[model samples]
Target: MLASFRERFSMLAAVLALGVLVGSPDARAETLVIAGDPWCPVNCEADSQRPGIFVELARDIFGEAGIQVEYRVVNWARALHDARKGRIDAVIGAARNDAPDFLFTVTPVSHSRMCFFTRSNSRWRFTAVSDLGGQRLGAVKDYSYGSVLDAYLLSHAEDPTRVQLAHGDRAFALNVDKLLNQRIDVVMANAWVMENWLREQGLGGQLRNVGCRTPDLPIYLAFSPALASSPAHVELFEAGLRRYRADGRLQRLLQRYGVSEP
Candidate 1:
């Protein structure tokens, strides 16, 4: 009976070893799906080699922990909706006001300086929310510029003459086109995002940032509130982020994308 028991234990060990060597399905890396609009420098084209800062950071951090990240480009509004329903795992470049219910990392990945842009030849300036009146303001739909601006935009949403809201992943680009064509007086945009767009499109001198809203806000990598794994995922990301920040890897990564740490 002792010899028989020993033989059974040896057989069980061999089977377990075979399972590991053969790549058992149970041991495969967990995959997290992150989706958002093409908010470049934050998150960019999904198929691009360099994708975006947050996307790459998630991949790097999760990849090191036996996890895989898949990024997808979708309209911001839909991305938020899907994340809420658990169709998508996470959203990047999200402001707190953008999705208050979503789980957010304690550490901010970057900051957004909301600025108003106008044609280089135009003289319109944005000094206050009141200044936005009498001017056809261009903005993206479902985006939170700030508390004051958000209130203003909400109030003027139905008034096309007061505000022209663009939708979809290319909303920012469309707004810029409107500004350049004299269709809109001023367009609200993120300073860093505008800088990246102008640089990429070679339209550097075509427009100028007249003024910016005060109190720049931090953006984050937010996860679906409906996902059971969200808590663990956020914890993992937070730990990895702290390590990267402490080691200067975060700063270097930002620099590579021509972005300054916020």
Candidate 2:
């Protein structure tokens, strides 16, 4: 009976040791928790074989630095909020404008030109922000398009009679329906995202891009201050991104996803 008890105690100790080795926080050192909107072609859900154009690029770049990645798909607002609160390690494919609290990298993970779309028959010719007065616009709830557009959204939308702006969770997809039903007159979104969505929804050529040819928004994988390893991680990621760009791997990846270089 004494011998049997000793053997059982030894087995229990070994199992506990193994559990510590497996469950230690240090074991997850190089793993990053990333979250974002699953904007197709721009950034897709994790289950997707290729993910999305920028999602794969970020994975490869960070992987080059020996980091493993886990992604969560959520609304843009929530993604930014969680990153700000340090519930996650980083925000994927985000701009500094999107999350001012997060630290951004000099290396951009992806590129996207912002544009506005209008129905073909609508007479909304956009030469300037003043022209947008009196027209209804569809915009994503938490999106920061650009300085000019953001200013207009903040200042002009106060009076619904002047420049009425409608907000939605899935702004691009919802805007398509709104435009068809005349619920909104314009949609402000990424050029590529909107184009892909329009094609998928079988509304190609139905809307015209009539906004300013704004410069592309260079997206970066920004880190949350709540993360203890943020500074070191951001440095490693920037180095990895530089190497990725130098090797021309980014171009090949974009081509695979039918995305163009900006």
Candidate 3:
């Protein structure tokens, strides 16, 4: 009986080894699906004329690994939702802690500074958080400014009416149009994005930066919890990222996409 058990175990081990050699689903065809918003300059875009820096970096890294990568451009809300559901493998170029459902990678590839924008002629000067009190402010929907800003706003719950959220383009347009129509007081956004949008919309001359939150926020590539469970893939990605950073390739890629070092 013991001899028979040993034979069965040996056969099982052989079968497993054969499976690995044959490239079974568990070992073969490692495909990673990444999602991001194209509207944001650093992440995603529909226009082939101008691709995002983060997308380019990811493509190069995965290409080196001989892994297949699929990128999907979706609205910010849908991207976050799908990431939470594990319907997507990863979310690229997201602000750390932007969503509670996803786990962030330890290394951040880029950073963005949050700033307040207003009409050049506006009287409001944003020196502190209190300046936002009793004033309508525009911000991208579902984007976290940071913990300090979030906590400050939450602690002053009585000023709920002071905050107003809008989608990215809409929020930016609102700021422009508000200043034109005298509707809102200020609009908050990442400095790069705000500048890009302003220039794209031909409204750069009409806006001015009032003040900005200190300590620029870093953006990270976030993975769904499902993907995080696979330690192998995580290590692979980190290794690839480290290689890119070490060779100055990462910085060059960012510069190619108009992302200056912050």
Candidate 4:
């Protein structure tokens, strides 16, 4: 009877030890979820076989820092929404000051300019923001074009309906169609992306760049406020990024995706 009781106690103690080990915090590894729009060629993609340049650079940076990264390919709006909600730890390529809810790293991995696309044969020229006042302009829905353009549009809202905001998976296609059909006067897009899209669709020669919204738009790796607030992890990732940038590895990766150095 005594031997049986001792055996039972020993078994119970072993089970308790195992339970404690399983429940320990150290047993679980830390992972970061990064989200981006695959439509933005430099940032994200749907093809598992070919990752975007920014995605590849991010993976290398975070991997070197001993952090595991899970890439989530989402729509532009959803990706921004997730970043704001802390559902995503980071965003690969985001414009500076794009969102107030996120924190950006000090160094940018890439840069591009925002430009307007118009019909190839159109005589209309765009030199300033006021040039778009009387013309129908197609812009991405829910996107902030900064205070300057926003204020200008607000002042001229009644005149020719200054801006025509559009949305959906077919926004770009719709914009292009509008230009082709002479429905919308112009379409706004990032230069590199628009050029690539146009080339892919065999419409490159049919479109012409009217003007650029800004001289240069710097793209950075943005992190949710919640994630950035965690000093240890944020610092780890930032350090990794800095190392890549310093060593020119990030530039090489961007070049692989046809991103030009500025």
Candidate maximizing TM-score: 1
Where does candidate 1 have its weakest 10-residue lDDT segment? 10-19
Residue pairs with clashing backbones, model 4: none
- 5-47 per-residue lDDT for model 4 (tens digits): 6534543443343334346333124466787664456754545
- What residue runs in model 4 are displaced by over 4 Å at the alpha carbon? 1-28, 153-160, 228-233
List where candidate 1 sits over 4 angstroms from the true fold. 1-28
Expressed as tens digits, the lDDT of each residue in 62-131 for candidate 3 is 5554456677887667777887787887777678668755666567777878888887887787777877
Q: Give the TM-score of candidate 2.
A: 0.83
Error of 2 at 239 (Å): 1.1
TM-score for each predicted model, relative to the true structure: 0.88, 0.83, 0.79, 0.79
Cα lDDT tens digits, model 2, 101-190, are 788878787776887789998777777777777778777766777778878888866665444444434655776788778877887778
Q: Each model's C-alpha lDDT?
A: 0.84, 0.71, 0.67, 0.66
RMSD of each: 9.2, 11.2, 8.8, 11.9
TM-score of 1: 0.88
Q: Pull out the clashing pairs in model 2.
A: 134-162
Best by lDDT: 1
* lDDT, residue 176, candidate 4: 78
What stretches of model 2 exceed 4 Å from their correct place?
Answer: 1-29, 161-169
State the displacement of the C-alpha of residue 74, model 2, in Å, after optimal TM-score superposition: 0.6
